[model samples]
Target chain A: MEQHLVDCDLCFDALQVLQQQQYREKYQPLSASMQQYIRNSIKQVSHAHKAERYQRQEQKKESFLIYFWVVAAIAAGAGLIYLIQQQDKFKPSVTKAMASNAEIPAQRVEAPAVQAAVVTPVRAERADTLSHRPAPPAATTTAPVAPPAATPAPATPKPVIKDSVKAKTPAAVPVNKDSAKKQAPPATKPAEVKETVKAPAPEHKDTPTVAKKTEDKPEPKPVPKEKKDDDDDKPKPKPATETAASGTDEFLYKAAMVYHQQGDLNEAISRYKHLSGSSGKYGELSRYQLAVCYRSKGQTGKARRMFKEVVRMNGSMKDKAQAALDNL
Target chain B: MLQQLSNLSDKELISRARKLKDQEAEGVLMERYSHLMVAVCLPYLNNGPATSPEEIYPALLQRLSDSLKTQTIPKANEWIHYTIRAQQARTDKNSPFFPSTESREQQQIEARIEKAATNQKEQQQLIATIERTLDKLSAEEKYLLKEFYMNNKSFAALAETKQISIEKLRQTLQQAKQKMASLLMNETYE
Candidate 1:
């Protein structure tokens, strides 16, 4: 047989085949016990793999959700900041309107003696001619009072009134009315006292409306302050999730699925690049999907490369790889 | 074992292992090569009918698991053949096979397999020197030889698994046999 195998090519090949088959026939059957052992080992290994794969998928799913929530939280924070800034902008105008209404009563309280002096008849005729000329000065003084009337805080009330009094350089007489009422028995005049107390009602009406709004939606103060401090203490996490730029492999892999689902094929292809750099089970899947995407877009070269990658990186992907290769 | 092989496309066998998770596919793989285990155990049991293959199979299966753990053999075929020869020698020493040159040859075959022949040239030289010259082929060639030899697969099934035409598969295998004959020829010359 050896000599014959050496001399003739077909006979030699047949001889090797014949001997091998004889060996197989002699001892190929497994005993029941061996079969059980094999079955047990296989089951154990498969279960382990199934468990591990499930765990990996669960972890990936959890991470994906975490990333989504982080992005949502950042957007909500930005929106809230814009709202607060908008509210702050309008705050000064409302406060200014309240301040102006408050100042009107303080001016009214000081004019009682002047009104009493004008009530006498002989003196009133002489006073009427002088008062007519003085009316322009009085009108100018009232115009100067407008800005201080609108100022909100009483602590700054004196400075604003002083500036208004200065602007009406000739309205020094009404300021004297204020000082005189401050010094003398003007508060002692019964009718004037009643008028002075009543003037504060309109001023109070303007202030309470703004005070009610402040109470309704209390500002997020202490919480934002503590959060800001904690944010400072920790390294701020890359602004939570800024739409991670193009070309980052991890981000690209993650974003590829997102963009593909969004029907942005161009962007999906762009991100699939990161996925192709490494080849494994998931990587093979990525290539197969990418090829499908490319084929749908009529890009044969890229589709071919991706499909070929699946074949070259074959293991789990062998059938898919073969199919793609056959198609190509 | 069926699930594991089912998991792998014949193409997957060509790629480098990406992750150890691919080991899941090893189940059907063991089944595919389960008969080879008998070939391994048969040579070990000369006085076989009373001891029974059932009893011998558990120890052989344990050895298979141990072999996988050691990663000493890359392809299942090489490990199967080597284990058969090795186990036969151990059994012969303890149980008394032929009480002749059979024991010596089995020991020699085991030693030849164990000898480190790193490069293809050294390995081919060793195969020539060794009386049993089947050890020199590359991992893929070894697998084809076994599928053709131990499994008794049809040419079509072999071709399908190998992802080649049956004609091509036959030609490649014929070339492998020629190389084996050539190595055996070198043995006579040396």
Candidate 2:
């Protein structure tokens, strides 16, 4: 019928006549309603499929986020555990090394040793040297010039100048000539004693402290001057090595200072290095000046190390070294 | 989406409906055959308690829908006609729809004809094969086919010329076409 209808005008005309019949009107609306109903059913099925797909995608995303957080938490917990273990490993070394020096919590042997440890290495060494030195026979005589400290040989470490048992040199000397007359015979010391006393005064900034002492103790002049004479006589009574060590330390310090002033950093660094081992004022001073020279020469790493050493030395330049280190 | 689905052939729509469980493709296929179904069932409407147009059409649609899911339908017209006739007789038989070999052959030949429309050489080849197939048929079948196709005679006109009913004429024309398709396919396979 289709093959015939394609070439036949009569069949096409008959199809049009059949389409014009009332049966089309009867089924057309029904067919349209059926199509709409079917479309609605299809839309419902498609919507359900889309909802299922969306729900699956959301579940996958949620699971992925859960995995990510779990991994992150595991990494963080592992890192924290490592840090704690590292801290635990270091704790015993600290407690053992500081055991004798610092007081143990259970038995705090004494805190004076801890204080001695905490004190600057220079001041602590000075205190040890002073305490180890023999008590001069003129200690009681020098009481008027001495500070008010009364501690024994193994005393708790004080500051750099806790010399109550020793005499104040400048305080004992009269600054003007007239007051110098009344104390002449008693204050007269050997030329060697006087020269030894006066030889090391102008090295660094310690000379001003001497003048400050005289100004501070102008009233107790006569007794302290006798005490000063006793202190001068101490050099002659000392071992030869003591004076010789002091002389070398002073000479090395002066040579370093000369090179330092002349901008010869390499030579100065070498000289300072030599002097820095000797535990005295020059040792502390050389270390501090070495750090300063390093800073000037732009060897920042070496400079930082030297400054840290000075700060650890707890010398007069500790504050300056700490500030420079903080800036660096 | 409906416009694009409407553009698909009956075979494509059947494939989508069966494999993808696409209701819209099924709907397009049903709507494509709705007029034919209505025309076939028009005489049987209100003939019995179950034969109302509304009842018969819905029931026919339901049977076609159920069969569409499970059956391999090569020819939708034959499947829909079987479903409509089954509904009209109130047979209550649950037999699944299957395409006859003749229908499959006819469908194959129709597909080949459609494919060859673009290539003139292939189109001439197909035409020659069909003519050769036509010449090999019995005289009565061959005469019915030539009158219906080459003469462009309507089924009513041919039935009137033979002094037979239009239904018988249509049946004879159907048999002749099937014979031609079977002959063409048998030759192709050989």
**Could you tell me how far off, in angstroms, the CA of residue B107 lies in candidate 2 after the best superposition?**
1.8
Model 2 agreement with the true structure over B67-184: per-residue lDDT tens digits: 9998877767667766766666677778777777887887798899999999999999998888898889989888988998888888778888899976567667777888888899
Q: Given the true complex, what DockQ would model 2 score?
A: 0.08
After TM-score superposition, the amount by which residue B10's alpha carbon in candidate 1 deviates from its true location, in angstroms, is 7.6
Model 1 docking category = incorrect
Model-by-model lDDT, in order?
0.50, 0.63
lDDT of 1 at B184: 54
Looking at candidate 1 chain A, the ten consecutive residues that score lowest on lDDT are: A231-240
Q: Which regions of candidate 2 are displaced past 4 Å?
A: A1-29, A46-328, B116-125
Write down the TM-score for model 1. Answer: 0.31
Give the per-residue lDDT of model 1 (tens digit) for A287-319. Answer: 677887797788888787767766665557768
Worst 10 residues of 2 chain B by lDDT: B35-44
Q: What is the DockQ of each candidate?
A: 0.11, 0.08
